[model samples]
Target: MSNAKSYIQTVALRDVKCYAFHGYYPEEQLTGIYFLVDVEVTFVHTGDTENLNHTVNYEVLNTILLEEMANSQKMLETVVRRILDRVLDTYSFLQTGKVGIRKLSPAMPGEVGHSFVELSYVAPK
Candidate 1:
């Protein structure tokens, strides 16, 4: 059979809230902060969508999110990069993936809602 039947499937986990210690300052590191994470991935699939095996499991995604969030990093870039890398590595059929992490109520003098970073991946053909 031709590959014409193949289609792309996307899975996303949005606004995943977590409390973790991640910041540039030592004081901020000592005190944990709330975070919001969003993960989205698209994959090529030609098989029937009848089972979890047919697509990426979101539970696994959440687990990865929580695990990465728990690990304190100095930069939001590092955290988001790790999450994106993990997602792309986990699925062999992935076409593209994106991960965004936001720090809520950052340690800043001025009124700032949040600071964030986003990382994305695209599999080479």
Candidate 2:
């Protein structure tokens, strides 16, 4: 599909931390850092006012992000993919989504700013 035809929606959570094994270094597993996530969803709208069912629910998206954050993985990319997949699987209204995950205070000693990975996916028609 063409980009012009897509409808988009965004949800973001800033500065959330969960302890988990998310790094290559041994110390990383022992001590995890804060992670940030931002999600954007795109879908085709029928433009019917009564069709709330056809739209994505922001609350559900938030819950999914929270659940994914609580469950730690080895890579932020994996986490981002999982969150995107979870949303797509649960909500059919999303035709596409972009997910961004940031790892604050990475394992690098002098890394002053945050490190992050982002991924985008489009649902198959």
Candidate 3:
């Protein structure tokens, strides 16, 4: 059988609000920082909305973002990767996912408005 999917559904959590600590510097870990996390989960829409069983829950996505941020992974890349991996693993229907995390105001001396990182994952068929 071909590995092509018939229908694809994209669920996105854009700039989901969060104020958690995640950084490498001592001050960054101590003081903590606010961040904006954006996540996109794509899956095969099997037209099973009536069941809601085969679908991914929106709350799960939000929880992953909040829980991961609270862990202080020491880098945005880690957070992004974790979120993507977790989402992909949690949902068998999920095909691909992307996570984007941006620090609202970096602690650096220079005027950096936001420091951001984006990561993506695709599950094997």
Candidate 4:
């Protein structure tokens, strides 16, 4: 067997559906929209992986997303940035991460699947 100094692990919360009134257009604000949020974070692994403290909790991520989404904004970029900031702030052990928000059936002329924005985080050296 080979000895290793440390391991890196990534935890993700995917396809989280949320309904919020976030849009630049007035009509979109009135009608509201469905969004799918995906969050993932990479961190240095600890020996006590079984312990909740040693790893990122999915519930915490969900809570952050919901809380941020509750506050309506004209742009998804703002929401995504807020989510990423919260995640990084919540866990000091986090190394890198990404937060993505997708607006389903966006209010546009042509048939569009979704409009998406993603923000990433990297811990300072």
TM-score of 2: 0.77
Question: Model 3, range 1-125, lDDT digits (tens) per residue?
Answer: 89856678888889887888788887788888789999998887887777657777888888887888888778788889888878877886678888999898787798898999999878786
TM-score of each: 0.92, 0.77, 0.87, 0.94
| Model 4 spans with C-alpha error above 4 angstroms | none
Model 2 weakest lDDT span, ten residues long: 6-15
lDDT of 1 at 117: 89
The regions of model 1 sitting more than 4 angstroms off are 1-4
Q: Model 1 clash pairs? A: none
Model 4: per-residue Cα lDDT at residue 10: 91
Q: Is candidate 1 or candidate 4 better by TM-score?
A: 4
- Report the poorest 10 consecutive residues by lDDT, candidate 4: 1-10
> Would you give me the overall lDDT of model 2?
0.73
In candidate 2, position 4 carries an lDDT of 54
Question: For all candidates, what are the clash counts?
Answer: 0, 0, 0, 0
lDDT of 2 by residue, 14-49 (tens): 445554557767677678777777877877675554
Ranking by lDDT: 4, 1, 3, 2
Candidate with better lDDT, 2 vs 3: 3
